[model samples]
Target: MRPVGLALIALAALIPLFWFAPLAASRDPVALFSQYLGTAALIVMGINQFLATRVPGLELVFGPLDRIYVLHKWLGIIAMVGLGLHDIIDADMDGLRGGPLADAAEDIGEVSLYGLLILVLASVITFIPYHLWKWSHRLIGVFFFMGAFHYFFIEKPFANADPLGLYVSAFCILGLVSYVWMSVLRPLAPRGHAYKVASVRHINGLTEVLLEPRGRGLKHVAGQFAFLSVMGGGLTEEHPFTLSAAPRDDRSLRFTIKDLGDYTSRLYRELKVGMEATVSGPYGNFSMPSGRDPQVWIAAGVGITPFLAFAQTLKHRESGPIKLYYCVRERGDIPYVADLQHLAEETGKLELMIVNSLEGVRLTPERIVEDLKGDLRNAHVFFCGPAPLRKTLKNSLVLKGLRASRFHFEEFQMRTGIGLGRLAVWLWDRGIYAIEKRRAEKTQPAE
Candidate 1:
């Protein structure tokens, strides 16, 4: 399995070990384990807060920002499970209850657990409105504060100044600081590049936003994305959008956004020229492959944004004979086709293929091999598209003689989950398809 920020996991695991080391000889094993569970869970919660801070260079400890968010979600789930188990076992030491303060701490812990449950539910349930979810998410630190208070004040098997106690206190302070920096200080004093909207255009179902820098701008490679916080026109939330244009000296940026969600719809309808926006990134690891290798570039719908930058950066005709497959619902749905076509014709290196799914044109692995008509042993394949399309094409192409190592793609998703909504439907569909295929083969004449 890929590393889900193993640093955090190791820290959480080790803390419990340290806490349980001296107490291993204690006769009350049940209570000891309960205390262990609570300590581990609280540590995990602290790690989650740090992950959410999105501090620069954190991608080194964690993976990319996208993967960090995914890890954050899972850590939240694990922390909740640990907390629940701790509560179920009733975390209490034998004959060590301090009077009134312990009672209040216990009450505080209960309240924090319930609060976290509601907030985590709000986060995981996809149907919740994004704005409301964001609002609930910001309040998580308050409950974390309560939890830290409980940890300090409650009657425990060890003194507050002991090694484990100091460690937990350190985590609590770090988590709280991270929380305050991200949700409180960052908003009042932004850390991103300042820019003003130079232009805004609506093309078909997409919105192209052009931003000119107000001061020093974000320096980023093509295909990397940045979080945009537009100031006015009912757009208060910050959202990540990929820069569609290549990097330039002037530092102006272009974001080609599709009107798919509430925020994007509002941006498309209400955003005006001259509106101020803050760009909080220069994030993601997605970029063009280096060196001279015959390449296959595939994009679907708005997935074409990153490839637009890729196309713009192709300066030398000798660098590549890159074959670009632009998959669209219809030919008319794209506004950048002419730009790509012009570039291809000028360079004599890039080949543009538009696959219109509305027509009967489907891009399959067979088609790719036929078009190449050569050995695929050293070819690099880069793709950005819907998950289903990526899965189908990646698996099929690998079977059809493409090197698994040569195939490249980025997960690039921010709000991934445990697939609670589509898991059942997907399993059902796969089962039905298999049964029908088997039945059809049985009924057919022997081939």
Candidate 2:
């Protein structure tokens, strides 16, 4: 189906629960609707998170389904708002005051208050932009677990009162269990080995940290990433950093991270040698296929880090037939240029092309296409950069009659949750559904 068709279908499925107005006004509609919507939102969030980490083919769905993902995030915010509204505007507030909710709130007292506080904290933290979200998102997970416990014990009375609420509660419990299992419990399972940072090297305005895994070493392929978290620090903050070192190096693993923002900028200043860090994986499919065909790697700025891993892998194997086009704003912006140059010198099969767009030397798609006219037909192009640059290159490749399968890329941004509360607020603010009306022309029916 088309992207719009899929979105319309999803909207159709979700809208009816809200649009049905009053389903027996004697019942508390707000509470009832909020329970359903919030549960569904959590389920969807869990599914999306799981798919994002585990599924490779999700890119096909997510690529065209960006609008659905946006809607999902807004819907999550809306669900949170809906829950808040349900609490505030509950018709049974008087009954609840003297009953289960109130008694639970009073008996547990400070623990209940802390759980509510944590929920509020999680809501506030999620509102930040994607980049900052990475550093702060782990705390949100803490809030999630706290909230789950609160819901399990304190709020069980309300959920048990109604059949619909019972079902919602059950589903929510399962969803929370699944989320925690996939994200936290599974990753922390004993692997019987550990890695320590041997040396942290600062190169080309980026930090390249070498990791030495004790015992059986980490088995990884080129162009994959590992989720690394420093010991003593909470597991919630484990960030995925691409491996810049060759996979063949069993003795150690190296990660080159640019000082882009929060986590990275502090790596050199705060992280120390001999610090034991846990590495979770070597995930991603941005490497060249095994067959013997020419390959081109297009990298912009810090995107060169992954290519370093690929180059290192090729170097260790003494394999060639791969060309790299490294583009940057200036000559100084290029990371590991000398190393890449040395690799090119050592391996005659490797070709290096550096394009400086800022030095009045514009690197247009047309120019790149012309440069690789012969090789472009067979080579699979792997590009990593900012969205706009990727789009330009993608469009250029499409115009040149290149297949979509020939291109590969990765996004560094995190997908934030969308709730129904945010959607309502957005619609209210923007009047998004205001469709243009066309005047009906007078028509005569044929006899």
Q: What is the lDDT of every predicted structure here?
A: 0.84, 0.60
Residue-level lDDT tens digits of model 1 in 265-342: 999889999899989888877776777778899998888898898888887324657899999987555779999998
- Measured by C-alpha RMSD in angstroms, how accurate is candidate 1? 5.0
- What would the per-residue lDDT of candidate 2 be over residues 1-447, giving only the tens digit for each residue? 136544643553355355334443544665555444444444443343343343345434544233334443444454455444534443232223243454454344334334434543453454555455444544434544444443444432254446544544554555466567656786667632378878988877788888888767677777777677776433235677788867764757888888866667667577788888777655665666776666778888888878887876665564437768888876554678889988888867678888787776656777666667655677678887776788888888877866777887765433533354576698876653443221222243446
* lDDT against true structure, model 2: 0.60
Stretches of candidate 2 off by over 4 Å are 1-39, 46-170, 178-193, 231-237, 249-251, 315-321, 331-334, 374-377, 414-447
What's the TM-score of each model vs. the native? Answer: 0.89, 0.65
RMSD after CA superposition, every candidate:
5.0, 9.7
Steric overlap count per candidate: 0, 17
Task: Tell me the lDDT of model 2 at 258.
Answer: 84
